[model samples]
Target: MNYRTILITALSCALVACQQTPTKPHAPNNLVTQAPALGAPVAVYTTAKNTEQRLSQGTTLTFAKSVQPSEGEISVFVNPHKSFQTFIGVGGAFTDASAEVFAKLPQDKQQELLTAYYDKEQGIGYSLARTTIHSSDFGSHSFTYIEEGDKELKTFSIDHDREFRLPLIKQAIDAAGGELLVYASPWSPPAFMKSNNNMLKGGKLLPEYFESWAMYYTKFIKAYEAEGIPIWGITIQNEPMAVQRWESNIYTAEEERDFLKNYLGPIMEREGLGDKNIVVWDHNRDLISQRANTIFEDPEAAKYAWGIGFHWYETWAGGTTMHDNLYNVAQSFPDKKLLFTEGTNERFSRDKYQHWPNAERYGHSMINDFNAGTVGWTDWNILLDENGGPNHVQNFCFSPIHADTRTGELIYTPSYYYIGHFSKFIAPGAKRISTTVSRSHLLATSFQNDDGKTATVVMNQSDDDIAYNFIVEDKEVELTIPARAMQTLVY
Candidate 1:
């Protein structure tokens, strides 16, 4: 029985591809609380007898529904109903993986993993990625193309980043058949280009460097090209609104418009970097109004722009029903695309490590964005050390895959598997489609591959088992969702 065909309901003439019957009841809500240590109990349900508990989590994780555990086959049909496309990938995490971390892994394991990373045709796929033009909080330290006090015409080069980060990233991209999509952003301009003369202090980009900084970015792009890496997209600044002690700079709406309208856009056109696109407002989602205001207000700045970008840090309810963290900023103007540029699970909470095991959270973030019509999705950092990062400020969070600094032991977190559900099956060209579930706890989105085969991925991140009946083309089937587990039900 194909899981996807039973549940998907095609709007037009369609065929059932999975075993989804409407008669299947929603899974019962189950809770895993006291009586056992935090992670001591492990129970699986699909294989349980009728009198047994069907859904459980504690020790090893199991994904099973109430249905009998036969060797039943499920084939997912790719019916991409939505008409949109963009790149998807993780950012800052692996690009800046320390030499210390790389040296720890065995040469064979390292090569194997790198091959797995780039050989997208093989499965583990990353079509798009975000990188700091220089060092952001996720990097070794803060630096930029031009040094402080070098306000002259003679010295402007990206020699700092040229040393290792660029080369390391290029190696991975080269192995992937060179299909990686790169979007570069600056956490903060070099200290000399900022109001503050120190990289550690919060400062705004000085107006004086606006034009020269655009030139600086061109050089960075040219330097990477020299290394055989083509940058697909770029943002004016990382978080133009946030001014952190780490590598950060603030850009008010006025400044952003002036920079893009008067400086960056014109310079890119002059240098003939027209093929690579530029996106605006690479900041939080809550500022949709500000983004709409900025882009809508300026015809030229908006004209030269490719799309609008947002991060998932701040929650916006207006866009919630549309998609989990989606905002209504782009509703008025639907022509431009909305892409989630950066988000991470590490929020400096007291229980940072506990956050790592909750693959549901990462799953929630991805589905929320995808449901909201985000063209693509990208996470903050792919790989960070045990404490979340090697951040200079010591403010850290966990990564999808963590490498023990001392042992080199790799612990694949929930984020990794959560990403696999979408990335592994939904390649770069796949388009999202409409999907309806029995209840709200089970969030879902359907996609159609290039060959028109439909892939539907659903997540039951709630603590209880929620049975699902996916109807496509008027045919339905039963799918029992295990509690606190995510299932990619495809036909």
Candidate 2:
């Protein structure tokens, strides 16, 4: 069934008070004489199946004595003390299309959109952001910062960004309470620097221009900083393995490693941009292991790399998402980090704004990725036009939120609430804690924020409403999750 129909059905059930099987109280686990205090009561915020609730605050839950799980009864157990990776943050990209659309919206709508995404209380509280270095397929056209054939590296400027992109980014930083970790990635280097002399198709960077290309990154970083936008990090290339119709560059595993070790790494240091994170293999999960191994195995190359960045498009060929690959990389390189750089539901249709699966796609990935050891997650475009984009090559895709520039209205997709389930409650510097679920239908992940508050996210994708016990340490809270819903229990 279509999403709207499903949502209507779900809402009807909610209004009528859908019945759930009750769980009989079980004997307390006598393993502990006293269970640790679970702090304040947990505030439940949920986005439920077929309901208008989008991150809507629900009933508060107080922890009681722990109960033993009965067979077939679903339960989520969270261990906040046992933590894994530190969470960087969760956010979306500020692509040219997003910026351009923002520029077209009415003044109040612009503020509304910015507030909807960045305000800690009113919005989703995004703490991370990504943007293209110059131009990507999401831009209106391909362009470079410098004039063509200026190999002397004297003509660098970012005047193009001052018009629309920079303003939006600056406002976003302000809306985010004056702090947002922003990063950039290049789809392709300038045409003159590539073998094909065009940035549209996949082409290798000519060996002669390696140093110049390395210098380009430093220039971009400095220019943006001068514009009052601090660049937190940058990926060497976006989707280095793919050959697409839009801007793309090819770099085999070995080639990317060499460029970092011998060129990009040292240049950034010499230019005093060493503090900026250098991420390698901003590609997909399918070959993330190969790319991470090749670059991270080399001490020289690995030294400069802050982490490995990846995308979610590897599943486009109808293959299962290679989530285990992320675990393998994390297990292999405990010192390095993993960041989900970019991902969005592709092939956007205006009618599918309420599409439930798009949101499920996000919940599924975020849970698995965090469980598998990813520090942060980034969605591709924060906002796109009604057409799904003003994309240069018409490579349209779905964003969590889209603006109908023609109508001056904003559309918040289910994906937006799906992402908010995590980003809103889990602050940066939060650490992933251990969470065990008793059923496969219910997926869960938990994080303890720096402020000592723990947020546990549980997603129910099954068709049947499920009653589950939320357990932490020796405390338990009985909860019921509607079919195809997600909840973030925060205390």
Candidate 3:
């Protein structure tokens, strides 16, 4: 079916579901239904078994008196009053590769992409964004803002980004209703500032260049702001513990802590850029807790850190994702925030554009991460070419949306819809409410918006379609989730 037909059918289903009146009880054995004073109608949207059903609106469920769930029956319970972390937002990195690819697309396609990601009415509302400090593996080449030996940074300029990156970022901010919380991260400092004098293959930041390196962040923030792109924060380093063929830098937890407290933090304050958030440990979950302890346990360093940032790459070794570590850090330092800074399905191939597992990966991680007290989440690259790159190090990876640069065609992956299942309904400033599920096959999270609308996202990964009771306080609604599908119920 065409997009218009699908949208209309979905909306029709929602309208019918919302307007239907309840008849006398034909209550099932598991639920003894009684009339409850209903509040707002619950509108359900699903991206389910059918590819056409992406973010499609389904029936609006009616509230009935809460019933005790039977022994084997599945149920999803949401408590709107009991809330946790205030959501910052959800989005992807606007990397050089994304920007360069975006520049190659047709004008109309470019507009379509911008609207698809940033326009709340026409697209998934992405209020948060990330960009690199210099060059990353995702970029075409290694780069720095200043001349190689310019420690004084007087020769610093963002002219390199003027051609593609900066313009795309500015347009994205405008598309996001003139407000987007953007954070910057560096994969490595300039080669001259590193011990190995190379931007690739993990090297340490030379101790002598500590002061100049700190000043680099301030200069980047100012330069971007000068172009009318306000940076919300900066992570000390990206994947600080990893050694890769691409740009990388290593920082022992203590070294990172000392650098922050002694150099970066004080320098920012001295330069009057202290208000910008400073995020540390932009690495994986395996070392997150240790990194948090090393930095947070030190009062001076802790004062500089706005939060801890982590990635999901540690799971690449073929083990369970260490989601528990996030909770451990959150509980250990309640004052410090947690952010899922980067995650994306690697090993890209044109054939896997419609890959469902990729989408499920996002759904699974996002639900658990938010439940673990993460305030925000960011995906890796916002857009990539059909070949999955323009990647300099030949490390091509998947993006939720890929443009076939040759054909000027856009391929929307299931991951895009999966991400939309949360980002679209859960607004910024929303508070995550308490949500729990009775079945192991299902995963869920809920957030209550400032407007009193609650978005409860449910994911069914099991093979069989499951019917469950969606319970909210004293009321409940019967619902069925398709196998390997995700739904967002908004009320």
Highest lDDT among the candidates is held by which one? Answer: 3
Candidate 1, residue 287: the lDDT equals 71
In the range 172-290, model 3's lDDT, one tens digit per residue, is 99988888889999999999999889999999999889999999999999999999999999999999889999999999999999999999999999999989999999889999999
Worst 10 residues of 1 by lDDT: 20-29
In Å, residue 130's CA in model 2 sits off its true spot by 0.6
TM-score of 1: 0.78
Where does model 1 exceed 4 Å of error?
1-100, 121-123, 315-327, 347-357
lDDT of candidate 1 over 1-491, digit per residue (tens): 22112112111112111211111011111221111122222221121111122111113332222232232323222222323333244333344544335545666655645543444444245556777777787766666666566655257666765565665577667765665777788777777777886665568878787877888778778777887778876888877877677777788887888888899989898998977778888888777567657765689888778777787667434443234224355454555667778777655443444343456666677777765657667777666666666687876866666666566666545455566566655655555554555456667666555444444667765676665554454233445666666555434
Q: Give residue 434's error in model 3 in angstroms.
A: 0.7
C-alpha lDDT (0 to 100) for residue 73 of candidate 3:
94
> Global CA lDDT of candidate 1, please?
0.58
lDDT of 3: 0.86
lDDT of 2: 0.85
lDDT of each: 0.58, 0.85, 0.86
Clash pairs detected, candidate 2 = none
Ranking by lDDT: 3, 2, 1
**Stretches of candidate 2 above 4 Å error?**
1-39
| TM-score, one value per model | 0.78, 0.93, 0.93
